[model samples]
Structure formats: C-alpha cells, structure tokens
Target: MYINGSWTDAEKKQTMEVINPATNELIQETAKADETDAAKAVAAASTAFPGWKKTTAKERSSFLLRTAAILREQTEELAEILTAEMGKPLKEAKGEIGLGIDYLEWYAEEAKRAYGEIIPASSSSKRLMVLKEPVGVVAAVTPWNFPVAMITRKVAPALAAGCPIIVKPASATPLSAMKIVEAFDKAGLPKGVLNLLIGSASPIVGELMRSPEVRKITFTGSTEVGKKLIEQSAATVKKMSMELGGHAPFIVFEDADIDAAVEGVVNSKFRNAGQTCICTNRIYVQKSIEKTFLEKFTARVKELQIGNGLEDGTDIGPLIDEGAVKKVQEHVADAVQKGGTVMYGGEQASGCTSDKFYTPTVIADAKDSMLISTEETFGPVAPVFTFTTEKEAVERANHSDYGLAAYCFTKDIGRANRVMDGLEYGIIGINDPIPTTAQAPFGGVKESGIGREGGRQGMEEYLEDKFVSIGNIE
Candidate 1:
C-alpha cells in the first residue's frame, strides 16, 4: 500500500497474495489495507488539499507532464508487469500503457485550460464572474480490466484539476496501479497529494463512503457496486462519477462492406477476450448478408491464438479466474438450450496451462430469450442475431437497460446518420469499431453510468464552480 508519500503496510501488517490468471501462479504478496488505513489516507488527502489546490495551473501541469515522461520512458517494463498480472496480451498491454500516457499528456494540457467565465453585470457598477476550483479530496475505485488505462483516466484529471486523491484498485490487479503511483512519486509529486490502498473492497469503500472529508468519488466497475456506493454515500452528498456495465449491440446493415464489417466485429468483440465494458455483446446482421458475415467473422475468431500472455503470438488470454470460465460455460449452455446453434469453439480450451481458458465461441440464430442476449458474458463468445429491416434492428438495439456503447456498420451516409441518431447509447460507432479517444467524451446513459470521462469534460468531474458578484466596480 502507498499512502502519504511512502510505501507502507496496513496498520495490522496484513498481506494478500496476487496470482497470475493465465498460469495460476503466485506473482507477489501486496500489502492489504483495512478501514484504518483508508481513514489515514483520507486524512492525508484532506491535509494536503489546501496547499495542493493553491498551486498555479502551470505548476500542476509541469508535474503531470513529468509523470507522463517517466511513464513513456519505462513503457516496456510497465507493460510486462501489467500483462503478467492482468492477463492481457503483451501487445495489447503495451497499447494500454500508451493509452495511459496519452491521458496523462492530454490532461496536462487541459490543466491550463480549465476556463472560467465572465458574465455581464446587471448594473454599471457591478461585475459577475465564475471561477473553477478543485473539488477538494477525491476517492477513486477502478476495475481489473484495463488496469493501467482505468487508473490513468480517473487520476490524470484529478491531479490536473489540483485535487488530492486516494485510489483503491481492484485486488486482482494492484501491481499496475502501484507502478503508476511509483512513477508519479518518482516525478516528485508532493506528499499526501496522491495515495493508493489495496485490500478487500468492502472496508476500503466503506470508509470512503462514510468519510465526509472526501468530496468526490470516481468509480469504474459493475452496476451493482455502483448502486451500493450511491446508497452509502448519500449522507455526504459527495459528487460521484460512475462508469458501469455495458451490453453493447453491434449492428451490420446489408449495405455495409462485408469484409470490413467482419474485421471490425472481430476487433471490437474479442479484444481483451471480450471483457471490455464497451465491447460488442450482441451482433446483429441484416438477413441479406448474414451468411457471408458469419463465415468470415468465424474464420477470423478461429485465427486468434490463445495462450499465456507472456508467450509470443498469443492473441487471446485466459479469463480472470475459474468463476469467469464457469460464467462463459453457463451462458453457452443456456444459449444452446434456447434454440441457438453452436457455430464453433464452444468448450473449455484444451492444451492450456490452466482451466481458466475458454475457447472462442460463436452461436448462430440467437434470440433474446437466451441468457447471452440480456446478460454481459464478459468472455470470448459472439452470439449472432439477424434482422430483416433497419427499424427492427434499431428497436432491438435500444431495448437494453444499459446504454453504454453500440456500433453500426453501413456505407450509406443518410442511413448511417439516421441509425446513429436512433440508437440510445452514449458512445456510438458508425462504420468504425474502435471510437474511443482522449479528445471525446466517454460514458453511458440510463443505468449504465452517471458522468463522463475523457475530453475537456473529464477534468470537470473533479472541479466545482464558484460564482462571484462584485459591486462598486468603479
């Protein structure tokens, strides 16, 4: 655990063993934090906030820029540690590191651009102005998938906006978070400005929820947990940002380029072995091109090599644990039982070092009655559903409670605009599968989430507005 500018153990000196999901081997034992440690971190952040927020924007920008430089210098070492702990492919892990660097660099510039406003006065002797100030101390909870990217996305903006933060990363992937904090500390971050706690989620989060010192909480994880946080934190009325579960729908219209659509679906659905919050969950293809799309898509999925992330030429890695494997199996069985056909690779992968590996699976003629249709499988399984008309496709895609992300592939410009408008998701990709970038707002609507990350809006999540009115301006 890292708290108040130093690496320290929990007050009780407890530790938790971290296991590599791919090989099921013990990697290292990390310090385990409890409620007492959480309170100490909160106190530290609160103590640091008054001075930290007083620094000029340019001064804050310099610290963030320096940290980004350090991360860029140690990309390879950090990437390997991330893959070893998180089970993402080495190349993908490197890409995540690069993305983290992008966020830090982007927010460094945004630090200087948190613009305030000057409003017209009602009288000649009066002046009205609004100022942007840091929202005191923040507490962040990040998920296991995309460990580096998730932490950077939340922490970069917090630091750039001049807030002291305490991060509680998922126990499954604490090393990546620890490494990032180490980089910031190496770059000369001030004491108590940034802190990290690793341990059971209940005690750490419970402390965060009950502490009135923490003015903001940013979380990226499941919807169930997000709700619990909301319920617990209602007493303090802390500002909260929640990026929760997503059940994205991938729609391929008949006019879409079949080969390009196939490639896009494969990239969107299977990257990180289908565990991403925005990955395509249900693939809908027009009846006219259904057969051609499935053939090419299945071929591409078959070519994905599954093995330990450290091994060369490995594309897909193991699920996070045995329970993940069991969830995939259960979804497949339920789909097959409800009139879905198993196209290929629908069993536990053989010849792998552990039982945590599941073969890439595809199910055809999928219906909404199946478990895979409504629930997020969070595995390498693609369930294909066909539609006859554009209206039906849009209607079906907009039916889910989750409104995080949805994708549509079509070459028709007019139809593309229509479909893009019709979908209810927060982020939509038309003819392009991967649409996330540092310059655009990324979040969801409805039950998916509450606030946005990325773009100029991301920094706003950590800021508060103060309106000042001055009289006798003469």
Candidate 2:
C-alpha cells in the first residue's frame, strides 16, 4: 500500500491472496486496508492538494512524459506481471501496456493545450473569461480487468490536469497498478501527487466517499457499486466519473461479407476471453447469412488453442478466478436449460487444467428473457440470435439496460451509418471488432455509467469551469 508520499503496510493485519487463475496458486498479496488507511490516504492527498494543483502544466507534464518513457522501458516486465496476475494472454497483456503508455503520452501532449476561453459580453470594455481548473483531490476506484490501462485511464489525465489522486485498485490484480506507480514514482513524481491502496470495497471506499477533502470519485467497476458510490458522494456533492458495466451487441447484416463478418464477430466476442466491458456478448446476425456465418465462426472458434498465457500459440486463457468461471458456467447452464442451443465450447478447457478456466462457448436461439441474453456474462460465452429486418435487429440490440458499445457489419456504407446512428452505445465499430484506443473517447451510456475517458475529452473531465469578468476603464 502507498499513502501520502510513502509505501506502507496494512495495520489491520488483513490481506487478499492473489491467486493465479491459470495454475490455481497464490502468487502474491495485496494489503486489505481498513478505514484508518483510507482516511490516512485521503488526508495526505488533501494536504498535498494546494501545491500540486498550483503546479504549472509544463511541470506536471514533465513528470507525465517521463512516466510514459519509463512505461516503455519496462513494457515487457509489466506485461508479464499483468498476464500472471490477471490471466489475460501474454499478447493481450503486452497490448495493454502499449495502450497505457499511449494514454500517458496523449495526456502529456494534451496538458499544454488546456486553454481557457473568452466569452462574449455586452460591453466592449467588459470581458468574460472562462477558465478550467482542477477539481481538488480525486479518488479513483478501478476494477481488476485491464488493471494497467484502467490506472493510466484515470491517473494520466488527472495528473496532467494538476490534480492529486488516491487510487484504490482491485484486490485481485493490484500488482499491475503497483508497478505503474513504481514507474511514475521513478519518474520523479512529487510526493503526495499519487497514492494507492488495495482493500475490500467497504471502508476503504466508505472513508473516501465520505471525506470532504476527496472532491471527486472516478470509478470503473460494476454498476451496483457505482450506484452506491453515487449515493455516498451526494453528501459532499463531489464530482464523479464512472465507466461501469456493459453487455454489447454485435449486429451483422445480410449483405455483409460473410467470411469477414464471421471473423469479426468471433474476435469481438472472444477477445480477452470476453471479459471486456465493451465486448460483444449478444450477436444478432441477419437471417439470410445466419447459417453460413455460424458454420464458419464455430469452426474457427474450435481451432483456438487454450493454455497458459505464457505459451506462444495459446489464443484463450483462463478467466480472472474460479468465481468468474462458475458465473460463466452457470450462465451457460441456465441458457441450455432454458432451451437455448449450445453450438460449441460449453465446458472448461481441456488444455487449461485449472478451476478458473472455461472453454469459449457459443449459443443460438437465445431469447431476451434468458439471463445470459440480458445480463453481462463477463466471461467467454457468446449468445447469438438472428433477426429478419434491420429495424428488428436495432430493436433487439437496444433492448438491454447496458449501452456501452455495439458492433455492426455491412458493406453498404449508407446502411452502416444509419444503423450506427440508431444504436444506443457510446462506442460503435462498423467493420472493426475491438474499438478501444487511447486516442479515442472510451465510455458508455445508460447502465454503463457516466462520463468518458481517453483523448481530449478525458483530460477535460477533471476540470471545473469558472467565469471571471474584467472591465478596462483606463
């Protein structure tokens, strides 16, 4: 645990054992901080607030630029650590490191351009200027999936905007985040500019949300926890930015290139073993091309190699833990029990002999009433359905409370744009499957939570607007 400008251990004598989902062994531990630790972190950030916020953008960006460089130097080491801790394939983990580095670089450039604007006033002698300033201390509560990138998503912009941050990384994979702090700290980030704690959700979160010194709550986690944080933040009226749950829909049209659409759909659903918030969980294919798409997609999915992430040719790895595997198992079992068709990969992987590994699964004839269709699987199960009309496909895709991301495949440019407009998602990819990038805005709508991350919009989230009027009468 890191608090105030130093690294400390949990005085509570409690810790969470981080187990490798790939091999079912305890890899390391994270401090399960108590309310005292959380309070101490908040107090430290509060104390450092004035000085950090007063620092020039150029100075702050110097630290961020150095951090990016350090990230590149340790990319391979950090990527390996992320793979062992979070169970993502080594390739995906490496991809995450690159993305994290990209985010820091983007924000570093964005820092020098955070300019205030002049507003029009009635009188020529009077001038109204609007300025954007840091919103005090920020408490960023991030989830385990995509651990490295999540920290960079929040910390990069928050630091660039000259705001001190106290981070609460998910207990399962805090190691990646800790390594990130190591890089930033090595880059000579000032004391108190960044703090970190790993613990249960209750008091650690409770203390931060209740503290008036913590001016904002930036979270990327489940919708249930996000709402609770929203309620708690009401007391202090602290600002918030949440990137919550998502069950994305993938729609394929009749005229789409059959082979291309099938390839895109499978990759979209099974990437990261489908644990991604913006992954395509429910796929709607046009009836005219349904049979051909499934035959090819199922065959391709069956050929994927499932093994330990360190292996050279392994395509799929285990989920985060046994609980995640069980959840995916239950969802698939329930769907089968409710009359859905399991086309392929419905059980644990034979190659991965761990309790946390589940085979990539595909289901057909799944109705909206089934839990698998409506709920987020957060695993490697893909439930697919067929639609006759474009309108019907759009309607079915928008049925869920989650609207984080949606995908559609069509060669017809006009139809692609039209469907993209109608789909109720923050991120939409026409021909592309994986749409996340540090250069673009990443966030969701509805049950997926509020605000955005990445790009220029992400940098602006930490800023608060103030208007000043000046009159020259000389």
Candidate 3:
C-alpha cells in the first residue's frame, strides 16, 4: 500500500495473496493493513489538508491531468493487473482503465469551475457571499467490481475539490488501486495528499469514522454495507456519498425494434460477466413480442465465448470466485423452481479450468417472486418476465427496493416520456442500454445510494458552503 506518498509495508508486516479469478491461481501478494495503518493514512491526509486546500484550482488540476496521461501510457500493464485480480475480460478491463482516465481528465477541468455565489441582501449596506471550501480529509472506500474506475470516480472529484483522501480499496482488488496511486505519485502529487491502504473494512472504516479530522466518506458497494457505514459515521456526522447496489430493469416495449433491443441487452447484461451495478438484472418484454425477443436474445447469448480474461476473442470470463458461482446457481434454481424456463446456458461450463465459469444463461417466463427478480444477479444470468401493458411494465420494474438505473426501448416519443417519468430510478436509458458517462450525474435514489459521483454534482459532495456578510463598509 502507498501511504503518505511512500511505498511501505504494513505496520504488522502481514500480507495477503491476490488470486487470478480466471484460473484461480496466485498472482501476487499485497500488504494487509490494520487500524494502525489506517490511522497513519488518515493522519497523513489530515496533515496535508490545510496546504492542499490553499492551492489554486489550476495547480491541483495540473497534477490530475498529468496522472491521466500516465494512465493512458500504462493502460496495457494496468489492464492486465486488473483482469488478473478481477475476472473481467481484457477488453473490458482496458475499457475500465480508459474510463478512469476520462474521470481524471473530466474532473481536472471541472475543478476550475467550482464557482461560488453572491447573494443579494435586503439592506443596501449589507453584502452576502457564499464561498465553497473543501470539507477536509476524506475516506474513500471502493468495491471490487470496476476497481480502477470506482477509485478514480471518488478520488478525482475529492482531489479536484481540494480535499485530501485516504483510500481503502476492496481487499479483493487492491493492486488496481495501488497502480493508480503510483501514477498519481509520479505526476508530482504533493506528499500526504493521497494515501492508500488495504485491510479489513470494519476496523479501517471505524478508525476513519471515529476521527474528527476525517470530514467526509465516499463509498461504492452494496446497499447493506452503505447503511452500516451510515450508522458508524453518525458520531462524527461526516458528509457521505454512496453508490450502492442496483437491480436495474430493462423494458422492451412492443413498438421497439426487436433486434436493437436484443443488441442492447446483450451489450449491457454480459459486460464484465454481468458483475456491474447497473447491468440489466430483470428483463420486461411486452407480451406481444415476448417470444420474438427471447429467441433473439437467447441466440446472441449463446455466442459469447467464455474463457480466461487474457486470452484473445474471449467474450466472458470466470466469476470472481466459487461463492459468486454458487449465488448465481442458487438464483437460477429458485427461478426454475418458480416455473421459469431455462432457455440457454443455465449450468457451469464444461471445459473451463475452474468451476467458476458459469455459462451465459437466459431464463424465460420469469416472475417477480423468484429470488433472481428481487436480488441482484451479479453473474451471467438473465431472468426475463413478460408484461401486458406499459403500466404493468413500469409497476413491475419499480417493485424493487433498488432504484439505481432502468432502461426502456420505444420508438414512440410519448410512450418513452411516460415510461421514463414513471420509472423510479436515478438514471433512465431510453433505447440506450449503457447510461453512464463521466460528464453526467451518476447515482441513484431510494435504497440505491445517496448523492452523485460524476459531473458538477460530484464536486459538490466534497465542498462546504460558507456564508459571509459585510455591512457598513466602503
């Protein structure tokens, strides 16, 4: 772990092995930090916060721009490490690195635009000004999926807003986060401005939350975990931004082009082996075109080649571990028991090196009562249900406690507008399956998460507004 602008071992000198999920082989070992290390990192951030907040926005942006260039130059090396640690395919891994670069570049420019406001006062002699200031030290905890992108998503905005950050990356994927820290260090980032640590979540998070110097926490992971952090951070009342779990629904209306819908679903559902938070979990098709949609969607799913992530022409890779495979199996069995038909690829693959390779699956005649419908199926399984009308589709899609992202396909602008407004989600994709970008506000409502991650809204989470009034002056 890189802490206080230096590459160092854990205080306890303990280490953990990083395994390649594709082959279940040991890739490398990383330092395992404890509460002591967490304190060191947090103290480093706190010590740097004052000077970092004093620097001009353009000065901070220069470091971010340099880091972005370094990331692009080392894309191949970083993508390999990411794919080996997490089971995403090499192509997707490269795309993730590119997305990380986009975040750094976008936030670098967005930092310059963190504008304050001048409010009009009732009295002629009174002047009111609102100033934006950094919220101080930040604790950033990111998850395993989209390892690099999630780290950049949190760190870029925080750094751009002039807050020093201490990162606690997911233990399952720390190497990717370490690589990013290295790039930032090489870009001449000030000492102690950014810190990284790897350890158990509870202890590290507890240490950061209990410290009064840590002013904010940004996390991306499961909703249950987010809630726990919310409870833990209550003592200090830290500002928080969470991008939690999602069970996104993809609705294909009768008026939509069936082929285009199939293509969209294929791209969104199978990317990263369906491990992303915004991937399509439930498919709602109009009853009139249910059969047609299933046939096309299943046929496309069958063509996805599953193998090692580093291998060329591999469409999908293994799950992160055996536990993920078991979860996918359990969901499939429950859906099958609930009368859902297994259309294609329901079981583990035959010729894979490990049992972690679950085949790309498609389930038809699915109902909302099944476990797959209610919970997030973070695997290569698609459980599809049919709807009779637009109202029924919207009702079923909004039935879940999660509302991160939702998608719909329609040619009629009136129907599209109606469904978009009716769906309860943070992001709505109309004929576009992948609705996330560095330029847009990325977050969810309800149980999905709190606050946003990208765009101008993301910078606000790390800033505090201070009101100043001047009277009887001039």
Candidate 4:
C-alpha cells in the first residue's frame, strides 16, 4: 500500500518475510523499504502538512471517528494477521484491535474537548491566550509485541490533533500495522495525512528522525534504543515522547486475597508471554503471605497449556523469537544459582522442539541480588520474594533501575493508598492487575519511560502549545 499521496511500486526489490513464531514458518511477505522510500513517505507527509494542519478541529475529529469505525469493521482481519505475524493468542489479538479502535474513538471525541485558556492581561486593551496545535509532521515508531494497539495509540492521537504522520512499525511484525493503514485509507483519510514505511530500523528511523519535515517522535521500545533516539532527535531538537523498558513490581500484602493475587499475577505476567513493558516481573509478598502466595501461584502455573496461538483455549503462546526465549532461560538459570527455587515450569521445553512455546515459570525465594528480579526479563517468568514491612516492600520495589508499572493487592484502603503513594514507579494499582485505562494517564518514571501514553495525557504528546498576545495600538 502506497500511503504517501500515491500508489507507486516500491523502489527496492528486497522484502521481509512475516514469520509465525507458533509454527516457525513464513506467513506472508512485503517489500523491504529502502531509504528512498522513506524519503518519499516523509515528503508526501510534508506536502500534506500545510493542509492537514490548517484543517479545523471539527473536520479532523470527523475523519478520526471515521477511521475508528473502519478499524472496528476490519478487526477480525486485523486479529487473524496479528496472530499469524506476531504470535499472540488469537483472542488477545482480537482484543488488542478492539483497544486500537477505542483509542481512535476516544481521541476523536477528545479533539472537541481541546480548549484554549485565556491568560490574564494587565491592561483592558491587551489580550492573551494559549492554544494547542498539532506538531507538524510526526514520526511514530511502534514495537511488534502489541503491534496494532501501539500504532493506534500513537497514530490516532496525532491525526486527531491534526498532524500528518509518518510511521515506522517494527520490522518483525509490520503486517498488522499495514492492515491498520489500509483501514485508514479505506476510511478516506485525506491524501498523505497518514503514511508508513516498513523495513530496516536504521535506514527508516535514522532518516525520519533527521528529516527537517518530521517535527516530533513518539517511540515504544527498549530503553537503550530510546536513549539513542533521544540523542538523535536532539540533532533536530524535535519533540519526543518515549515509552521504554520496565521492571514492574507485583507486591502481595498479607491481608490480600491469596487466590486473587495468584490469578492476577499469572494472567498479567503470562499474557503475551511477558513481552509487555508493564508485565509483573517482580513478585514481593509480605513474609506472612509469601508461603501461601508461592504455593497457589505455582499450582496455577503448572496447569497452563502451552501451544500455538491459533489453538482454541491456549493459555500461553510462543515468545516473539529465539532471543526472547534465551533471555528468559538465562535469567531463570541465574536466579536458580543464586538460591531461587523453581516450584513450577522453570526449564525450557524440549518435547515441543518445532514449537516456540516457553512454559510459564514460577520462581520462589527470589531476591534482588538475582538478575530475574533486577532486569526486565521480557518473558514468561514470574519470580517471587518476601518482604517484612511496608517500608521494606516500597524500598524493594524501587530498588530496580527501571520503574514502569507497579501492582499491589490489599483490602485495607489506607494501606492501599499508602502503597500507591510510596511506590516510585509511574502507574500503580491496588487489588487491580491492569491499571491502564482510556481515561487515566499511563507511563513510567526513571528508566521505565519519559512520558505518558493513554487518556488525555497521550493526546498532549502529539500537540504543541503557542501563546498569542494582542496589545493596544493607540
């Protein structure tokens, strides 16, 4: 699909094979875009920028809502391709598309809500106001794990804010993102308003970030990569919002419902095989409940069925690739050597050699000294440890260099509030596993990330502010 105002054959002949990790086979293929194609896409976006930016908020909002409808209508196709291309469970993939649609619809309505504030002027003839405007051309880079949703989370708002966008989706899973762009085109988005180039990140991203026409960037990926992006973006001094790596802390209080805590950790940690940036990687329970927490969590972990993502009722799917599998294994082995106990599903599977499924693992007696508890494992490994007091739990959760989302369970409202306040991470939940919502802000502190991604906060990422003053000319 040629998104940059025209449908022309790609310049390069190279291509990327979309591989299904579940079966380790090629699913589909697309031309690997060269730097020339990247330039064409940005140029198309630059040409469209003047008109898109000049569009009234109401017109932009209407087009965004139409795009949302198009996304909803094509969700099934999007989900099937996501499962085939990225290896997420079909059901979860479907849900991810739904979330993508919701983000667009949410932002469509939000466009109307955008307001200008009047600044007090010292004199009657002098007037001042602050206005929010789209940040010219946006270069959005999204990861593969949650391909469809992450793209929508960034692209939807930029369009809603009246910005022409140029997207660079992950090379591993570009099909799902491609389908989304197809949806936008079908929805009749104006020419060059939304465009994308897929292939080598070095060629695509380097050129886009350095382009004078590209005014801002919103990225979701590794912290190391994000740091590099920040440095590169400095060259143009472009606007940037980064959602990087995370080491989420899942804390269980003694007063918590043991069954609920076990279920919460298993569901959130194993979903996507722990590929999420905010997945619960560290489990810190009150010393009194640690014994009970491990017993229940481990039992549940053993019952999960690992299989192909398309299989009905499959609880777990393959890691994105061999690198993720190796990383999870290394972390587990390191923890075991450091006195960690594997009560269930710790070893890699040899029985299913053809498949890429890594068993959901439960580690007990884990400590901060181990890599599993300190690093962002980014796999289906949940390590559990004990804490003596509120102060201790807070300190333990904050010990990591990365701080994204943190979770805690307690019926005591006061203690829940305290945990919410004391935790150093960006997003926190009390008795709730998923803290992300369309109405509230989501992001991280420290190495986890630099800015928020959801709710009203995300809209602000794609926009810039300007102040206008009118003085008396008497």
lDDT tens digits, residues 191-300, model 2? 88899988887888999988999998999999988998899889999999999998889998989987888888778788788888888888998888778888888888
Looking at model 2, residue 254 earns an lDDT score of 88
Better of 1 and 4 by TM-score: 1
lDDT of 3 by residue, 351-445 (tens): 88877899999999998889999999899999889999899899999945899999999999999999989999999999999878898999999
Q: Which segments of candidate 4 are over 4 A away from where they belong? A: 353-355
Q: For residues 1-474, write the lDDT of model 4, one tens digit per residue.
A: 366755545587777788888888888878788778888889889999889888887888888788888878777777888988878888989888888888888888887776779989888898899999888899899999999889988887898788899888998898888788887887778889988787889988888987988899899999999999999988899998889998888889898899998889987898887899988988988998777777788888888877777879877788888888889889999999999988887877656524467788888888789988778898889888899998899888884568789899888899898888999888887788877766677788888788788798888887788999989834
Lowest lDDT 10-residue stretch of candidate 2:
349-358
User: Which whole-number lDDT from 0 to 100 does residue 97 have in model 3?
Assistant: 92
lDDT of 1 at 237: 97
**How accurate locally is residue 40 in candidate 4, as Cα lDDT from 0 to 100?**
86
Clashing pairs in 4: none
Error of 2 at 113 (Å): 1.3
Please tell me which model should have the higher lDDT, number 2 or number 3: 3
lDDT by residue (tens digit), candidate 1, 24-71: 899999999999999999999999999999999898888989999999
